[model samples]
Target: MIHVLVTQAGHLEETSKQCCKMSETTSKHTSALCTMQSLHLVLLVVLTIFVYYVSKPHVTEVQPMNRFDVTNVSYTVSMAQPTDSIQRTAVSERTYVMVMSQKRSGSSFMGELFNQNPTVFFMFEPLRSLTSLAMKKTSFSFETAVHNTLNSIFKCELTHVPVSGWVVKKTEVSTCFNAFEMQNNSVLRQICSKYDLTGNQMFLNISSTLCKRRSHFAFKTIRITDLAHLKPFFVNDEFNIKVIHLVRDPRAVMNSRHLLHEENLDFIRRKGTHADEVKDLCQNMKVNIAYGQHIPDWLVGRYKLVRYEDLAEKPFQVTSDIYNYLGWILPQEVNTWILRNTDHDDDKAYSRTRDSRKTAQAWRKTMPFPDVLNIQNKCQDVMKLLGYVQFESRQSMRDAKSSCIPFNGYLNHI
Candidate 1:
């Protein structure tokens, strides 16, 4: 009887051992399967995000502050000839004011506006690399030359300068930088410097202009990308410049983009100088955003958010505001000049030629679906900050616009 009991006990032990082994194997297998599923799910999510960001169009904020490191210079000057306008060369009393901006953001136009000031003489993107070449200066630092020229132009401390026709006395982006000649003027630098000062300090000790009453000296430039990458050389005297932020709706901006090359990127690629301009404009905007974190706030008010539409609608007021902001006299001549040459009077031309306030909102029809979605996806942060909406479809856009409400108060605050 005792031997029978022992055998039964051994059989029971074997069965229990087999059951425990099966349970352990099942748990291991289930856990392995769950982990595999989790990994696949994670990969799918990562791929989706990557696709969204990559396929989207890029957008950057329209920041107009912190341009032209004016350490010791004023913008007041004297000029009688309209031909002496800033379209020729950038000038200041003692330094150059490099007006850095996107290509078609009207940086040159602003230079023209200041050039026409009775008290200011601003040359358009003067001191360009091509300009240096045309002047036969071997290895010229346009940044340095502008500093020397502005010191002389505004040293007299004059006011209310007159601006007329543009002069080709200078080298332009379009004139020199072209293909087939094996030339590449792709880099246009707008570095402003002043004598008797190091660019390290942000203070502009303008004893010359400060001592003179109603005296101003200034120069203007446009281009801010390469400098952004090389931010280590930021000097208040030579590089710290003020900015005038010119902003419009992304939709309107997109329209202007289309008008620039008929909205055809391919056409621009095949075209002449416009191709470079188009490329430069987009590149600059992207660089500006990437460096947004380092930009200072003083440059904010330095940015007078001028809407192209508002400028056209109230050229007189806008012109006056710009002059006032510059601490210069507002002359009747500028008003007359704007009236005669600008599209302020003609609503039809304004609408047709991309000058109307409503033109920006018109992008719902103009911008292609892919582009529209791309912008919406990539530039939402900036677009929302600027009070623009991402349209999902036609019905949604109409509903939003009809409300007459801007999301971020992003219009003509200047």
Candidate 2:
């Protein structure tokens, strides 16, 4: 079974990183006090040929009402029983999903989780589509011609490549980075093995399902949450598309980020405009629910908002939820399998001892108080609206604010 979890977080990441960059120059006192870090993460995200839109502000989390036709939602949520006469959805056919987000956070983690399913396959981020688009816009280059065909297929661009025996999928590169994820992504090989697929062959893994029909495949380019406006690319009814949205507390997100250096904005293009930070974050949560608010929502109270803390503390359970969402009963062997597959148990095992827990408070200890306030204040409205009280109680704030990133203040020597 090919299970899918779509996490859309393009600009949310770009914004925070840019915050680090601008904060360095914007604040006079913190410039030297705060050792300016390098810009690897930000650069990695920007230079990515996949090109999602974080340059814009006030990123609109797509509400169901924004686009989904009720009938289309029905198609997405429709389930086919193994014995049902309603015709089994074609196999050997492929579906696609784009793992999107600003840099950091857990988008990559989810992608890895989904990839683990034996039934799915992927191209981490071939930059196939973006390269293709650029090639067409300019003149086709040898480097991009192969992918330019891929980009054309995906963008449904001006050029039309004949659909032979394959599909072109366009998704974010973070999804392809195997550093945190693993899966039996052999459908590509299987398809190529089973069929004499041609260069013109194309289909899309819009639902992230493996091509049971196995054929040579490639995902062109997908819309990043920053480039969220492009979501309509998959919003129609003809092809069944499933979307997953992942959100973590902004606090802990900030903690993991402090370990990283700030990136440069020259690489990022400011496309969208901003209105309110907190409101946008809150609405993003709502948008996640609105699109896939099936019976038990995925975030809170039906919605499954995987707390990064919980995910790290209890990876199996978190993944079980993910597996379940993808409509699969996780194999009982998952625990032993994970142990054998990777060194993830260490990241998951809960740290014992008060000292260990205190060490986890790196964000609070290292981030200057004002930076914390800036992060909280920026997202404070969402905090309240989502039933997460503002940053009043430090202990609860630390515990609850484990989803997103926070601001970094002056550094205390480790």
* Candidate 2 worst ten-residue window by lDDT: 405-414
Error of 2 at 11 (Å): 85
TM-score of each: 0.44, 0.44
Over 254-322, each residue of candidate 2 has an lDDT whose tens digit, in order, gives 555555555312112112233443344444554443443343222222223343434444567666765
Evaluate residue 75 in candidate 1 and report its C-alpha lDDT on the 0 to 100 scale: 33
- TM-score (C-alpha, index-matched) for candidate 2: 0.44
Worst 10-residue lDDT window for candidate 1 reads 180-189
What is the clash count of model 1?
A: 40
> Could you tally the backbone clashes for each prediction?
40, 55
- lDDT values, one for every candidate: 0.42, 0.38
